[model samples]
Target: MTQKVLVTSIFLHAGGEVDHLLRAEGFEPTYAPALTKRTEDELIGLLDGVSGAIIANEPFTDRVLAAAPDLKVISRTGVGFDSIDVAAATQRGVVVCNTPNVNRYAVAEWTLAMMLGCARHAVKNWTEMNAGGFKRFEGTELYGKTLGLAGLGGIGKEVARRAHAFGMTLLAVEEYQDQAFAAQYGVTYVDLETALEQSDFLSLHLPLNAQTRHLINAERLARMKPSACLINTARGGVVDTVALAQALREGTIAAAALDVFEEEPLPADSHLHALENLLMSPHVGGVTTEARQMSGVRAAENLILALKGQAPASPVNPEVIPTARYAVSAT
Candidate 1:
């Protein structure tokens, strides 16, 4: 029987190059009908006979993985894997791979857009004017403004490079600092607390993990300057969603722009929905036509390699490969 791979990454074309690539190898491809994320139950239903999965940030919990006996590999677009239960996948001998650096520039560009939008009150002004209310608002220039990055990784470095061109001051918080890059870009290394207090635009580029989850909460939000803006193109759980809603509602910060959310689709009754001070997007920060294609191809290659009983490009849990369903030694 031809092995089946489920494509839940909307970024990957349902019938594009990767689809053709899979077909050429005699592998069958199936796509999720909608662009929305799939629940665990939905994923279990989708993975009935699937041997591999090309996914976005779908909830692939232990229960879902346990239900799919045939699944051998999972290739996710973009770098985040917080939604997947890696320990469970590893225990089940499933290879998990991620496409990284593919969306770095896309995310960096989106960060700048969000920063500028918040700085200039562009979203609020546009919303007001569209509703027939006329008001000219004073906007701040990025030049000479302090930009504190929560994490100085690939995306953060790109953001530093771009912000430097605008003559903005750069500060960053990272566990492992790149000394040469910091000196080249003139980035000041600081702790998260310092970044929060000093930044005119506090942008997040960190991952969501144990130490970093809810890294920004009520107390931290209070530390920000009243004229400051917060930009999050990274994970949403970094900032306390409830605290953020209260802050935005009370003008705790000048404005904020978020491309990701604690909850996907940000329910209709969410407190964030009515805030004119908040600008929200459907988690499309690391997304552009170019980036999407790069990520899609990388995800496809990882899936294809793992399915062929070979080592993938970037496996998160390489230890599983030896005993993984396909049973191959790591290259």
Candidate 2:
């Protein structure tokens, strides 16, 4: 019997040779509906007999995992797996893996674009220009500015590399102890308080976890320089959207550009909608065509390797491989 693999990521199987890869492995690939995420019940229904899955930011809670006894492996298209319950998956001997560094350049470019947008008032300028009004707001340049990075992972490193070319001084608040990277990029590691107080632009690149949930709130927003800008191309849950709205309304910071939100497809009544100093994108920072092709193929490869009882390249819970529901083994 050909094993079944469920694919929920919208970016996959469209342009990439994902189907060819899966079929070559003798695995039958089944795609879920479009990008609209499925509820827990819907997910369980889709995963009925699936032995492997390639998922997006869909909810795969413990209940859903328990309901799907045959599920052996989950390959996430992106680096962040906060949406999945890794602990529960590990406990049940289900291997979880993610494609890291696949879309690093795309996200890094988007982050740099957001920073430039905030500095040059891209949103307001475009809005005004389309309205048949001529209003040229004074803009600032990125040159010789201080950029504080909240996390220095793959994406952050790319951002730092790009920022260095533009003559930006880098300050990072990171747990990644890569002294070589720091020395090469001239990144000054600092505490959160110092980074916030001194940075001209504070960019976020952290995962959404217990300690990182709403890491930026009213108090921290108030700590930034009045002329500073905030950029978040990372997880939405890292910043408090309500507090961010109020901060923009009251000019707590000069401006902000956000690609992710606490709520996807931001509600119509969201206070963020009324802010003039805010720029927003619909979480497209890592969804470029090139990125989609690379990440999709990488995710498919992860699933295929795990299903073959071999170690995946980017296993989130490698400890489970020895006993991963008979789908994968440490090799």
Candidate 3:
């Protein structure tokens, strides 16, 4: 029987390179691009005989997994696994993998861009200038500012490295500490409260989990300096959208720039759209051309490896691989 691999990410292999790579690996590839919104039923239908998949933000719930008994591996094109039911995947002995390191620099750079955009009123000033106005929009400089990082993972570390070059002091709230790295980067590992209070620009780089979801609420917003700006290039659920809207409305914080939101394609009637202090992007922080190509290749490689009964380089559920139905034998 020929092994089948489904490609669900809209942009994956759009350039033909990853498709060629998949074909070169002697696997039959099914292309079902979810250009707009993909329903759960659509995903279940696509998983008919698929042994592996390269997916985007599509939800692979327990029901969906139960429907696809042939699904042995799911290789995500990005770092987030929140859309997928990881616990269910583990229980079902389905290997879950993600493309990490590849997009960190891109996301980190986008975070910096958003931070600077908020600090310098880039969009507001440009709008005013284009609308026949001048000398009305003043901007703040990043020099000698305090930047707080909520998480210091790959992307957070890259953000710190760039921010350091701008002569900004760094403060972080990370579970694990690397003293040597902190010393080299001049970063002070502080409690979340202190990081919030002292930061001129607070950036979030946390993953979306139960503990991290809505971690930044109204109270946390109130703790931040009234003149400070918030930047989130991380998962949308990390901050409370309702509270952020209110905070921006009441000047609890001076401004915010977000690439991700709780509800993607941010609803047309959302209050966030009405807040001028909030800048929004449609979660394209990791969608650069280079990132897309790298992510696609990495995800394809992971899927191929998992299906070939080999261990994937970046498995989110490594514990499941040992007893997986497709586990490679140790020779």
Candidate 4:
């Protein structure tokens, strides 16, 4: 008998490849219709006897999991698996996987672009210029600025490389020590306080876990130089959106560029929308054609390997495999 699979949170480009790949693995994959709160209901409807799911940013709460009792695996589209209740999935013996480092270059480039945007007040000047007013917008130069990176991982290293090439001083802080990596990148390892205080442009590239949720609160925001600009390309909750809005409104910092928000599809009433000095993107730092296809293909490869009872290259919750049985046909 052929196993059944469901794919949810429709990604336009990757949908075709995901369907084809699952079919090649001898599983019949039924894609849930376009993303919506009601899409959850659609997934439940299609998941009646489904064995696996290739999930995106849709909410996979305990209720959703309970509705699909036979679900054996969930392959997440990105590195962050916070959308799914991992504990509930573990209890149900569901294996969840994510593709990391696939979007490192794309996200890092976007982060640097945001930093440059903030420094030059690019959007503001462009808006003013188009309005037919010769606005004298004096922009800050990046050639001699200090760049602070919150987490010195793959994305952070790429940011450091680009920033260095632009003649900026790099300071990085990580939870665990890695002096060798810092030395190779010419990154000065510093404490969070010093990095936040000294940086002309502070960038964040960390996950949103318990320790990192709202890592940039009012207090941390207060530590930054008044002329400094803040950039966050990582998970949204990693920085407090409210505090960031307040900081931008009160001119606590010169400017800010946010790619992600604590809430997806940030509300129209959000204050950040009205702020002139704030630059916002709809969480598209890693949405380039190359990154999207790479992430999709990498995730597909991982799913195929996991189904074949082979170790996945990027298993987010490897422990779940202990309780779950690998798909039989994959072998």
Candidate 5:
């Protein structure tokens, strides 16, 4: 007689809604044993009787959905639902939702930090200092530098707002460019070429779609100012890793910082390891403690609502939600 929630991703903390929902007044829940491609297969097995689920960035392939006929809702841990086949889920009458607006600050702050770190050679300096040596390092100051933001969505706007406080000139590229929005951010709307040519620092905030895949390839990298630094907190494949490495080797640009890569868990033999001017972090732009807890708790709230026969605020496919089993009952 008890309802269960299945978690398909590894969480930073276990005490969030996973624990809360399971031990709460009238709910039962279970977290997937581990997070791996194999775990996803196991999740499909566990999901047979589960009413709801909380998942991470792994691909929820159509095969997985075919196994969960009783599923009522899916709560994505982050803002992106691209990994999940939303159309397939919708056709199967499953409600899919995500936790939005939770990780914007974490990612925005990390993007700016990477920009500064690359400019100042922070990682290289630390490496030398830890090796017990005195070293001289040259670095550029951010004030009055031009920054080109490739996307002007929530995360991009936050980066722009903070960059303004540092007196940085901002140029942005958005498919949905609005002069009014640009004015509010104190940014000028520019074409990609213009922004690349003039920017001292380039930060990407776009998603990985057909038009954006390998967006920063050899030709585009060639357009950047020789002294410019590139920062990407957006999805991998947005910048071509091989092209970037070539640019760094030839000093086509000053330096590059990336929180995401063309491949996740960047391969052990990856050439990026040999680039002195490259600053890298494990695709953790949004992996702060606050973001983790917020994602978990927010996912739980949305899942709970859907399970209780109510509408969730951030359903990926709103139309599907209305026709889903739980939504029909709630309505």
Candidate 6:
């Protein structure tokens, strides 16, 4: 019996490369593009009899996992796996993997772009110019400004490199500090509070977890300088949306540019839409052409290896490998 694999991410099959890879591995491929709004019922229905899947930002709750007993592996096309319940997957002996390094530059570049855009009032200036009006908005220069990083992972490191090139001072807060890296990059290791209070621009690169969810709350936002700008390309739930909207509205912070939001599609009736100091993108921070292609290839490889009972390149839940019932035989 040929094992089946579901390809749920729209970008994974972009050039049909992932499908080709699945075929080469003797796995039947099913295409059910979720387009970033996958419901639990939809995922359950699509996952029936699927041994593996390439998912995007779909939520895989414990209930959803219970419905798909045949699912042995889940390979995410991007680094962020917050949408998937890893603990539930691990308990079920399902291997979870993600493509991480592929999108570091893409997300880092988007972060810097948003930072510069917010600093220079790029969107507002262009909008006013197009509306048959002349409004000269004086903008701040990025050079000589302090950039605070919430995490110093791959994406954060890339951002630091670019920020340094632009002559920006760096401050960072990371759970695992690399003293050598900080010294080489001239990044000052500081506490979260100090980073927020002293930064002219704060960029979030942390993951969304129990401890990190709503990490940037009202109290932390209050600690930031009124002239500071916040940039988030990491995860939406990392920052409290209500607190951020309130901050932007009351000038608690000067501005914010977000590539991710707590509620995706950012509800049409959301208060964030009315704020002029806020810049929003439809979460395309890591959607560059090169990044997408690389991630697609990596995700496919992960699924194929896991289904074959071989170890995946980057398993998010490696603890399950030892006890996984479907693990590939070591030949």
Where in model 6 is the C-alpha error above 4 Å? 328-331
* The candidate that achieves the highest lDDT relative to the unseen native structure: 6
Model 3: how far is 240 from its true place, Å? 0.7
Over 173-195, each residue of candidate 1 has an lDDT whose tens digit, in order, gives 99999999999999999998899
TM-score per candidate, chains pooled: 0.94, 0.96, 0.96, 0.93, 0.91, 0.97
The list of candidate 1 runs beyond 4 A from truth reads 127-134, 325-331
Q: After superposition, how far is residue 237 of candidate 2 from its true place, in Å?
A: 0.5
lDDT string for model 3 (135-162, tens) is 5667899989999999999999999999
Residue 16's lDDT in candidate 2: 45
- Report clashes for each candidate as comma-separated counts: 0, 0, 0, 0, 0, 1
Instruction: Rank the models by TM-score, top first.
Output: 6, 3, 2, 1, 4, 5
lDDT of 2 by residue, 142-229 (tens): 9999999999999999999999999999999998668999999999999999999999999999999999999999999999999998
Residue pairs clashing in model 2 are none
Give the whole-model CA lDDT for all candidates, comma-separated: 0.88, 0.89, 0.90, 0.82, 0.83, 0.91
lDDT of candidate 5 over 1-331, digit per residue (tens): 6776777657723566557654573566776644444545765778877778888866666888888877888888888776788888888878899987799999999988998898788877888899998795888889999999999988998999889988899999998876776787689999999999999999999988778999999999999999999999988789999999999999999899999887666888998999988899988899988998888888888888887777888888789755556642321
Error of 3 at 13 (Å): 3.5
Worst 10 residues of 3 by lDDT: 322-331
Ranking by lDDT: 6, 3, 2, 1, 5, 4
**Which candidate would rank higher by TM-score, 1 or 2?**
2
Predicted candidate 4 versus true structure: per-residue lDDT over 1-331, tens digit per residue: 7777766645633347766787777877776644444455765777798777776777777888999987777777677787888898888777778888888999999998898888887887888889998887789899989999999888898999899899999999887757887787678989999999999999998988899999999999999999999999998999888888899889899899999998777878877788888899988898888887777767777777766666678887788775567646742
Across 1-331, the per-residue lDDT of candidate 6 in tens digits comes to 7888888887665348888888877788888887657789988999998889898888899999999999999999999899889999999999999998899999999999999899999998898999999997889999999999999999999999999999999999998999998989999999999999999999999989999999999999999999999999999999999999999999999999999999886778988889999999989999899999999999989888888777899999999887788954312
* Model 1: ten consecutive residues of lowest lDDT: 322-331
Q: Per-prediction RMSD in angstroms?
A: 2.4, 2.2, 2.1, 2.1, 2.5, 1.8
